[model samples]
Structure formats: structure tokens, C-alpha cells
Target: MAPGEPAEPETAVVIATSGSTGAPKGVLLSARALTASAEATHARLGGPGQWLLATPAHYIGGLQVLVRSMLAGTTPVFLTGTGFRPDDFAAAAAQLTGGPRYTALVPTQLVRLLDDGGAGLAAARTFDAIVLGAAATTPALRERAAEAGVRIVPAYGMSETASGCVYDGVPLDGVHVDLADGRIRIAGAVLAHGYRLRPDLTADAFADGWFTTSDRGIRHDDGRIEVLGRADDMINTGGVKVSANAIERVLCAQPGVRDACVVGVADPEWGEAVVALVVPAGEPGDLRAAVRAELGPASTPKRIEFGAELPLRGPGKIDRAAVKTRLQPGSHG
Candidate 1:
């Protein structure tokens, strides 16, 4: 784990994909795949110079920050703090004195930074690139980041792909990313070998050297991947397929809708109807009307439930399954 240690060529590294779906899985990554992905990122971003590490070393994204720094022959600046905050991250970046400094963060952190405004937002704008991962980025956040003069790159990758192979809405170099049967499949040297000790799960997840992710995606003509939430998160209502993530994205775009989640509830008529559990901004009912107006009838939720806040894991990812359990028949509202 030291700099230039040359340990086993790193065929795979385990990263805990957030348990937003059900259970988190430790994804194995390869050295070649990781390197290829890094190279691709550098090629597009004008090569790696110096990096600022704000994430935990245990996470794949955090580990890749170290890898990139070592590969560039530079030591990265670390964020020595209790937990993630805009002030701490900005202070860490301010300490760096060399080339362009880059850091990775989850969407929740980005929201906090945007909300902080003054020094935090100013510091956030100073970075060469602010990479976002772990969960989907809201359209509102993306716009806010741009207006703040910060260059933002939204990433889509798991531990199996060696952290991330897509940057700024574009796929990394030499990585073959595609969608098969609604599942996101990645093929390349960066693909993981298999799961640690679950052969059955591994067999179901991997095929012919390509790692199949549980998340659904669509590769647009521009070669950008549009992730459509997890496959298991889909809700089938009266023969109509509704994507919780897709609807959530639209709902989150509405004003006063702080956080949004779409879930399937058993219904005698439709079998299952799409219901929304939202974290509203002081006015839940008004936000619900806005969401309805935005997505229209089909995508609109049959009912909107309010929560003070959405459940979160690690950094800023919503624990969808946990939220589902909270919304269970007898659970607290």
C-alpha cells in the first residue's frame, strides 16, 4: 500500500458500493483497469499534476486519489478532519501550493458547499475539477456548481471498474461501457476479477470478463451514459414501468423539493403504484404540486409522504432500501 511498492500488480481492489439497493457488495478492481481509467482521465483533463484527498482511504474513490498522486510522482494533500465539510475541504485545498488541485465528493457534499455560499462556495470554485460519485447528481446541483465557476465532473463507476471510468459526462479512455438488457455492463482490463467469496453472486454478476452492474443505464448517441437507477428499484404499476430514479430526478428539479425518493406500494387495483417519499423545503404540499406539474400525470407520484430528511450512508448517498423499510406498512411515517 506504500508508494511504488509494486504489490501483485493489484488485479483487484475492494470497494463497498453503497447499499442503496439492498446490501453493499465489495467489488474487485484490476491494476490495468485502474491505470487505464486514470490515463483516460488525465488525457482529457490535461494530465494529473497534484491531487487533494478529501475522501476516506477505505473507499475506492479515496484510494484512487492516492493512486493518481503516486502515479504522478506527487504526494496528495489530505483532509485531516473528523468528517466531510465545506470548510475543512476548502482549508485542505488552500494548503496546496503547486499545480491544479482536484478532489472528489458526493452530491450531498456538493449541496452543502453550494448552500454555504461565502468561503465554502468560493473555495469550491477554486478547484480544477470537483469529481462527484457514489450517487446520481441532481440537475439543480450541476447548474449551481457551474454558476459558482467550479469545473464539475459527474462520475459513474463502481469498485469493479477501478473507481471511475467516466468523467464530466464522458466515458474514460479505452473503456467499453455499454448496456445489456437494461443493466450497465463494463468491459476492459479495469473490470474486476470477481467477488471475494460469493461464487454464486459473482457468477450472476460477471460474464465473459465483463462486469454487469445492477444499475440500469442507457448509452446515448453522444457516448454519454445515463444511469436509470438500480434495476431492482423499478416500480411496475398496472403494466406501466416507472423508474424511481428518473422520477426522483424530475422531482428534485422542482423548487422546494429538497430530497426525493419514489417507492412501490402494493395496491389492489394497480398491483403496485409509484409513491413518493420526499424531504420538502418547509412546504411539502406546495412542493408536491410543483413535482406533479413538472412530471405530469404518469410520472407523478400517487401520494407524497414527507420526511425531515432522506436517509444517508457513507458520504451523501441515500439509503433507498432503508428508506423503503421506513415507509413499510407499519413503520413510522
Candidate 2:
């Protein structure tokens, strides 16, 4: 929005989602939803302090940084330099001269900082909380951050819910997370008004104050929610169901593997074969064996390809469609 030109009175922010799976969407967030999200976050984080905006301002996670800062009456620190540079992040960190410093980052950015082993690493450890979202944070990443003593809170939410409503598997204050037939649904003061001009999509997604998410999850007995993966991401092979995200996590946990993206490919016999693209593709046979041992034979990838890095869509989401095309028959992967 242009400076001094206020947003519609009913809408505080209209975040445009990339909507990689379909057409893009403009999520209209009311001042109430935005404020509730920011306030609930502070309550969960033991009260707000300073927040650094590391991701792009266009994305929901980054937009909330500004919202949270406004609600707290504090100036948020922005990352310096073009793109995300560890050195630049560290330099920005040095500028926050306050207590209980906080920031949000994607898993890729967090991985870079932990690997920096310099000022960036030192700077990251000082934050009271670091909200990690915008992609599935693998167990390996969590382990790395924990070993370094950095407080990492894995958040689960989207633009439809006004940002991260579930932090570390627990819903924020006044927010409710549930599962209907295995699909995750959220209802709270944090929900966006609806898509700016797409009522059909809005009606299908939101109802009775609940915003249904594409991702499927398990509500643990302890009142914690465990997102299994996207509902459609379950791969059916040889009559057995398997989670591609499961394989990805297991692959990333292996030695010499930096990242992993698994997808189902067409196979005459199995219908949809499990295929994986790994970063640094270390010992494909051994990696396959490890996966077989962890998740069983049917879950093993029919093929594995190595890459320097994974393609991204919005924030740090792996470009699934791009990965599928590259790994498809006859195309260069």
C-alpha cells in the first residue's frame, strides 16, 4: 500500500499468496485477525520484545513481523544487503540492543546461520525465540539448532490463518486447531476475513469460523498437533500408503545429505512410484537402504537423484511441480 493511503477500513493487510498449486490469492486480513495473531504470539513467547524481519516483507511471515512490531510499539530490525546473507543477518542482529530478542526464519536460512560458525552463529544463540516456518523443518534441522542451544519454535500456519497460529504444535491463545477426517482445521480470532475477491474459494475453505487447511495432521492425546503432511501428499504404492515427507525427513537425517524432496511418479506396475531428489546424493544405495530400514520396503524410492539445492516457490517451499518435471521421464534432473 502507498504511504499515507490507508488500507480498506475493514482490512488491515492483503497478503498475496503465490498459490503455486493454482491461481494466486489475495488474503484479506482484518485488523482484529492481525492484532490477535500478534498478541497471541507475544503471549505464547512470554511477552514481546524485539523482532527482526529476516524474510521478504511480501510473505505472511515477514508481514507479521511488522504487525507484531507495530502492536508492541517497537521498531523491528530488517535484514541488510540483498537476499539472505549470514554476515548481513549477523550485522543486523548486532543492532538490536534490547532484551528477549526474537526473529522468524525459514529452515534454509536457519541452516545457513547454524553452518556459518561465526558471528551469525553467535548472534542466533542470543534470541529468546526464533519462529521457524514457511516450510517443513526437518528433524535434522531441529537437532542442529538444539545442539547449538538456539531456541527454535517450529510454527504451523498459513496466510489463510493470518500467519503461524500453532507454535511448537500448540495453538496460540484463543486459537483452536482440530482435525476432521485427518485434515487439519483452524478457528480463531487470527483467521483472515477471506480471499479479497474469491468468495467461491473462501466458502470452500472457510466456514463456521473454521479455515480448513490442505495439510493433514494427527491430534496427539496430549493435546499437541502433529502435521503428517499434505492430505494429497500420501503416496499409494503396491496398496500401501506412505508419506513422502516421512521419507524426506529420514533422508535429511542421514550423513552428507543437506536436503531432500520426495514425490510420486507414474509407474505402470505400482501406479505411483516413490521418487526422491536429494542434495549431495550421498551413496544412493546406502541412503535407500536406510530409508527401507526406517519406513519399510514399499516406502523406498524407486529412483534417487542428487542436486546442489532444491528449487523454491514462496519463501522456502520446495517447488514440487518443478521437481516433478525435472525428475520426469526424459527430462534433465
Please give the distance, in angstroms, between residue 50's alpha carbon in candidate 1 and its true position after superposition: 1.7
Model 1 misplaced stretches (Cα beyond 4 Å): 1-12, 267-270, 282-298
lDDT of 1 by residue, 1-333 (tens): 222543233545666666666666766667776677677766767778788888777877888888888787887998887867778877888887767677888887787788788676888887788789877888877888888787889988877777777775577777787778978888876677766555687899788877888788877878778888888887888887777887898778777777788888777887787777887765544555665677565566777788887888765678777777777656775
Angstrom error of the Cα, residue 328, model 1: value is 2.2
| Whole-structure CA lDDT of model 2 | 0.87
Return the top candidate by TM-score. Answer: 2
Q: What is the C-alpha lDDT of each candidate?
A: 0.76, 0.87
Cα deviation of 14, candidate 1, in Å? 2.9
lDDT of 2 by residue, 67-164 (tens): 99988888999897987888998999999977679999999899889878788888899899999998877887899999998899999999988889
Instruction: Kindly provide the TM-score of model 2 when superposed on the true structure, using C-alpha atoms.
Output: 0.94
- Return the lDDT, model 2, position 213: 92
Pairs of residues clashing in candidate 2: none
Q: State the weakest 10-residue window (summed lDDT) of model 2.
A: 1-10
